[model samples]
Target: MFETIFTAANRALVAGLLAGVFLIVFANVVGRYGFGVSLAWIEEAARHMMILGAFCGAGLALREGRLVAITALPDHLPAGARIALRWIIVAVMFAFMAVLLWLGLKFVAFGWDKETMSTGISRGIPYMAIPLGCAIFLVHLALFARRFVVQEFEFHAEDTPSDRQV
Candidate 1:
């Protein structure tokens, strides 16, 4: 139940962010060409939205095995080696993400006093994607660790139509 809700919410957020980017960019283009006026803030807003969307989608990507990786070696390994490798990978990922989350928080704090030139909002608002994305990735890694380590990571299982439904 919790997984369903959490997954749904994440999907909704990614979809909303993508739609916002599309709409904002479309409006800006129309305004520029059709009306001969360009909204100065649109570009900034779209960029930030794209950034947030990418970060927010990281967990979903990882869960579905969509993340880029060199699978040649892992794909050729024996079952026992594969499981061991997966555990090691998970441990490394946890450590890496933990450091990133820490650094991201510091980055946000450092930028809290600053504001974006175009949006005039706290710079920390945009910088927040780092820690948020890292945290989400961590939760996803934890939740899926057992399956991932026990079984070979399979993208097809996660790509079914039912799973695609938000």
Candidate 2:
């Protein structure tokens, strides 16, 4: 169930939000230069799309271990110490996610009362990405943490093609 839902959401966000933002920005640029016309709403709309994409994209990035990490510390540690540190990292991440979600909801509430300058849309709509992204980050983090606990290393080995394999 998790895999099914995650797959669909990840794909849709990349395809829709990410792609849409790029297209809108491109059009705005072209419209401004070629036609000498500025779209006030386009900028606002693109910003929202970017926020949504960043939040949604976070889950996939976490799953892929594409998020930032301090590799030197982990690699230098002994096996047992490394494992212990992994749990610590995951715990910190979850805590951060929880705070983000809690505070993000409040932010969204605050935004709901306000509107964008250009689009006149509720800022909450864009702020929604915070809590939403936090949730997605939590889910992916859980999956990765579970796998990390089970396998001491090479958590993403299955997802990637090893160079040595023929």
Candidate 3:
């Protein structure tokens, strides 16, 4: 269902980001040293690839719970309080994503009407990436919230460190 699709999207985004990094490195190195000449498109291509990588990677990070968080206080709280704190964090994240989504769409619309240009590409093309990324992030946040609501918060024995490991 939606979970499966989201998981697939996450994998795809990671792959694309990796590919972009590889392409940029290869093109820059080969063009500068081996060829003794630079391709005019190389820099622009790398820039766009970087933008795509960041936009897509953000959604994947959200899905994997790898985003930066301040949990020092929450870690010391009781179980109920910890769960409440997690929900509060999630709500704030959702609000932030919603604002990004709104602003992204507005930016795209402005670019479309203004008919801007960059790196030989229409400004709207690059602008579209913002909304696209925010939409994916919104979906990830919603799914994460749904799972949190259903499961509440369970402490797992597996999460604890063994005496030997400690």
Q: Give lDDT tens digits, candidate 3, residues 130-163.
A: 8777778778777767554333332335654331
- Best-to-worst TM-score order: 1, 2, 3
* lDDT tens digits by residue: candidate 1, 1-166: 8766887788899999999999999999999999999999999989988998998898888777667667678789997897789899989989999899999999999999999989899999999999998888888788888866664343554467655312
lDDT of 2 at 44: 84
Top candidate (lDDT) = 1
Best by TM-score: 1
Error of 2 at 90 (Å): 0.6
User: TM-score per candidate, in order?
Assistant: 0.89, 0.84, 0.77
- Report the Cα lDDT for residue 76, model 2: 92
Each candidate: what lDDT?
0.84, 0.79, 0.69
Number of the candidate with higher TM-score, 2 or 3: 2
- Listed per candidate, the RMSD to the true structure in angstroms reads 3.7, 3.8, 5.1
What TM-score would you give candidate 1 relative to the actual structure?
0.89
